[model samples]
Target chain A: MTRITRDQLLARLRQEIPETTPWEVADWLRDGKEITLIDIREHEEWVQGHVPGARHVSRGFLELQIEMVQPDREAPIVLYCAGGVRSLLAAHNLQELGYTNVYSMAGGFSAWINAGFEFEEPRFLTPAQRERYARHLIMPDIGEAGQIKLLDSKVLLIGAGGLGSPAALYLAAAGVGTLGIVDFDRVDRTNLQRQILHSESEIGELKVESAIRRLHDLNSDIEIKGHPVALSSENALDILREYDIVLNGSDNFPTRYLVNDACHMLGIPLVDASIFMFEGQVTVYQPANPAKGIEGGPCYRCLYPDPPPPGEVPSCAEAGVFGVLPGIIGAIQAVEAIKLIVGIGEPLVGRLLMYDALDQSFRTLNVQRDPNCPLCGDNPTVTELIDYEQFCGLPPRS
Target chain B: MSTIYIPTPLRRLTNKQSRVQVEAATVREALQALDEAFPGIGERLLDANGEVKRFINVFVNDDNIHTLQGLDTPLNPNDKISIVPAMAGGTVKA
Candidate 1:
């Protein structure tokens, strides 16, 4: 309305707002300063590249989403754009909303690149992906960004049996990009009672082979890898290295300890679940990764240092699981894996969730990180994966 | 009186009963009482040293006994004690 040109307006705002150069922002981030970075550029510009660890809140949505990102008005916040101009506007708007410590990146992403600073290329959801993950996108928890994460994540299932059946189904349905299934056993009629991923028509077929066909029919776009071999300590580390996370549904002590030790060594979180008769247990064993800032939890060895003496505990086949137990437990494992991938919700690390179907109750017990744990403890032991079968007191595989 | 949740594996020892009640003041006493009611359960839960086997976890209410006072953890009235053993069943193995 007033006779002010764009240059004149920019000059006036420059004096009113506080600004920090890309060098200063880099120093703050390197020093681990408590600062929130918001990229106030359009979606296209942001997907190309942006300041690493910056939240993308386009200029149009800055006012709407700023509160959710930074509730404390006095907290340090930095906003950047393609250049430095839009960030100034975003900072001004935030100030009007009573933000007291907002700073604009002097030259935005352009300045960051010129300064030879790091930038991250964010993955975006395609139009078809947008429609497919529309429900997830609508939720504030798992938006477009989170949907992209699900697409880029790879999850490995230790088995394609009762628990793996439902877990893989939901993980695939949720659009997890890569699903690797390791199972040497073939589908038997007994498995059909609960393993929904296999059908009666597919009896005697290799479980991994049957699983690939079932998952393809469910989601053709997703990649399904079949490792039709037994998972041994010899191969666990190599196979687990390819996955972002592991879902353990293994039925034997040798495999459980093997997978657990391998995951800990790799610093990959494991969503471990098991069913016995009508009862089930679910917990996440996350090894501490100091570099990535992931807190450690009580690992499998911490909870169960050694397997029950042989013959004292009945085998799963003899235990006789209920038809619906694995369904509930496996779905929970899938949910935990998704949470890990999207980085949302309070993970079940350091806690064991016990489900008693007969009583219709869920119980959570705290699992402590044993200071004397042999695998993950103050003093180091178990430096590498060992013979799980011999350790479990079972006959070694020949 | 406190309630001890007998896991499915131990159900056979407790006459196929899932929940067994015990009258005791400490976890050790409760487990002892459980043994008196259901013979052979003590052997299944305790090792040669009369302590919970390394593979088994004992809980008082929502906390593991290891984090508390171990088997000496005191139990209040109607408190729930759980004896959890690591289960490895994921498939209907033959």
Candidate 2:
């Protein structure tokens, strides 16, 4: 095999890939030229800052992803790397892929920076984060940008029990920046049957405290806030207002109603789920965001305007829940919460997903926002959080 | 005839049948048929004025009856009807 010097190789590639200067590329950007400018540098180098409005398709993935970046083979596309050598070779490779108008930015990002051209500095993933969320980083939808969003997001869990256990664990593992757990109950031996977040050693310990220890052990990269108090109308708003989205895993009609009402008023998206003997249901109640043209999805009240009378619907304890039911439902709740935080995928908004564990079937049913809903409807009532216990026909707690 | 999905709480009334086949032309008729097949379903499904209970939702296929035509919504020959109720059983204390 004949060996060639690096300079000779670059010279040969330069003859094939057209070279454009930083000034020319900057003008193209300023003049709003329809050009696809890509930064073909490594993620670490790209994070230090690169050309603004430039898409990062690293050299390693350039050949595989350029078509997805710019499907039009004849369209003007510019590629740049640290010192222009890598991008020159990458442009040659794109030309081989039949990209007719691929150009390498002459002298690359260093030249652009030296020439006083402005570049954008993005919050890059740390080495540990890149390793922790390696799967997510590789995904097209939840790439580095989406992972960063997850790391900066805060989600609150209504209960650190069955549903909250899995939801919190996954959220922490997924790198959701902050997690707030609201549970005043103590972990009990019975809870270990399905509440995987607690163990026998955690028994008699506050659920929130046990949950924090478990979640922190899972991922120290995230923040876990433990609100060891039962959520009521008084403190619901204050506690809930801190988080971007919420997961409703609390049992009993009082807590359900309280979380829904608070979330609706605060305009926070709530991923709600419930499990019975062999069935579990999950849905998202997103408040009306007129700016996003989201005329609000259905609230809990829209689906169930009133709660059932006490003893009418038995609790999980009375009905004996199929232990793993909440695992599926709560994991789904985590997925919805992650979607809400990352601002990707179609969430469970306006759709109720029912899982029949016995039949192993999932059915998605459409749920619409009620035009006459007392809380979220046009003619609204119940503006303030009410005593959910009394509202649900339960005696006030002492 | 339409297939109706009976929720967990109402399974006992439907003889532990998760999916029930009923002969009905409309959602209201379906509920009435469900009650006829299973004695107390109508009383549980409807309020005193015979309206679908507020806490419960009835869907013809994937769409809610309120979005369709309430109880008057016509049922297709092989449509699926789902009766969903607000269940609050997130954690077990017993």
Candidate 3:
């Protein structure tokens, strides 16, 4: 019943970020402010062409590897993605983690390249890289500052198939600080149709290995960290705690819930994207308070009180999704994550936007909080983590 | 006297009947009458606390009952009731 207008809400939220200007960020980047520019995009985009000197650590891996990227808590950091939503989420998360002086590039690379600044040609590739990335260097939205955002970013990907493919490719070509992959699953024959991260020779090989090789072949300047382990409860929180933000591409509900809960508990924002067939959805859940706004605002539990019953809802395993679905959804997820990291644009919160590719219909629903919600209710009952599988009634992993 | 429509999944609890007539001053009373005539239907329709489960969609006439007044939404004689699960499309691929 307490509804604040958009302007009023934003005004309240503005206190979370330290006010800075683009010229100031430019000075920090040039003046050796020890600034870290993060490109929160996937690897594939990085390969196509990226900002020179950017790291490739993904938002998912950023939480775990944030210290590695910026050991100095107060180091100046700038973040950017394709359209600039994810970086904003990232900047908010960084602020919550007690890191000051984090900035998000306004309008992201889309605006950077549109500014018509010079871009670094895709490096460490065949003579064809010039032709492949010829269109990138000529654009203004991905000019030098956007490229710097890419060069200084490090993105780690979870799940190199489907959604991760485009995300990885885009981030790689964008020139991130470092690129990391955490996936033990092998590239299967079925993956070729959508997993642009691996090729025919990569089938049956570890996904991280395949993704790293392709990403390196695309851009050698970015570092690639390959963790060949399935993210589980024992390791999920520990792994996610270090990174700045998390982008979830896993198809299973358990992983999704685990990531959500872990992010909230650790006070990290998660850029979530899901695709069902041709339909896709994307949102930024700032598990931390909205900077200057309400504390414990709305977590995933606020949207979904309880996990759906097993076998009651279909997964990509049971439900075949369209090949292009992840391409659309993952790219958007990358975009949002970068926006979050960089501090630009309004992040999607307290709303569920569902896309129906069949009819090309996008529906936005106002997700209200359940006053009796166990996690975020007026009087919460869930204070600690319970085995999500048990709560969801799934068989415990042996 | 309003007609109560049973969804396909719950029809087994109602002996495969598609519709039935019930008398009540409101939706809640009519649901209580249906539970009296049939058995175990209310358990699935209503949670343990008697509130409608979050996933089930109940409509009075053509309007969602939640938009009206939830379980307290009034019902009149000759009102039509339909119950449907929020079943989305798609089958698992793997």
DockQ of 2: 0.53
Lowest lDDT sum, 10 consecutive residues, model 1 chain A, at A309-318
- Residues B20-42, model 1: lDDT tens digits: 99999999999999999988999
DockQ score, prediction 1: 0.54
Give the Cα error of residue B46 in candidate 2, in Å: 1.1
Clash counts for all predictions: 0, 0, 109
* I-RMSD for candidate 2: 2.8
Cα lDDT computed for each candidate against the true fold: 0.91, 0.90, 0.68
lDDT of 1: 0.91
Scored on chain A only, each candidate's TM-score is 0.78, 0.73, 0.61
- TM-score of every candidate relative to the true structure: 0.82, 0.77, 0.56
Q: What order do candidates take by lDDT, descending?
A: 1, 2, 3
Task: State the fnat of candidate 1 relative to the true structure.
Answer: 0.75
What DockQ does every candidate get?
A: 0.54, 0.53, 0.14
- Write one digit per residue (lDDT tens) for candidate 2, span A233-301: 889999999999999998988888889999988899999999888899999999988987876788999
Candidates 2 and 3: which is better by lDDT?
2
Name the candidate, 1 or 3, with the larger lDDT value.
Answer: 1
CAPRI band of model 3?
incorrect
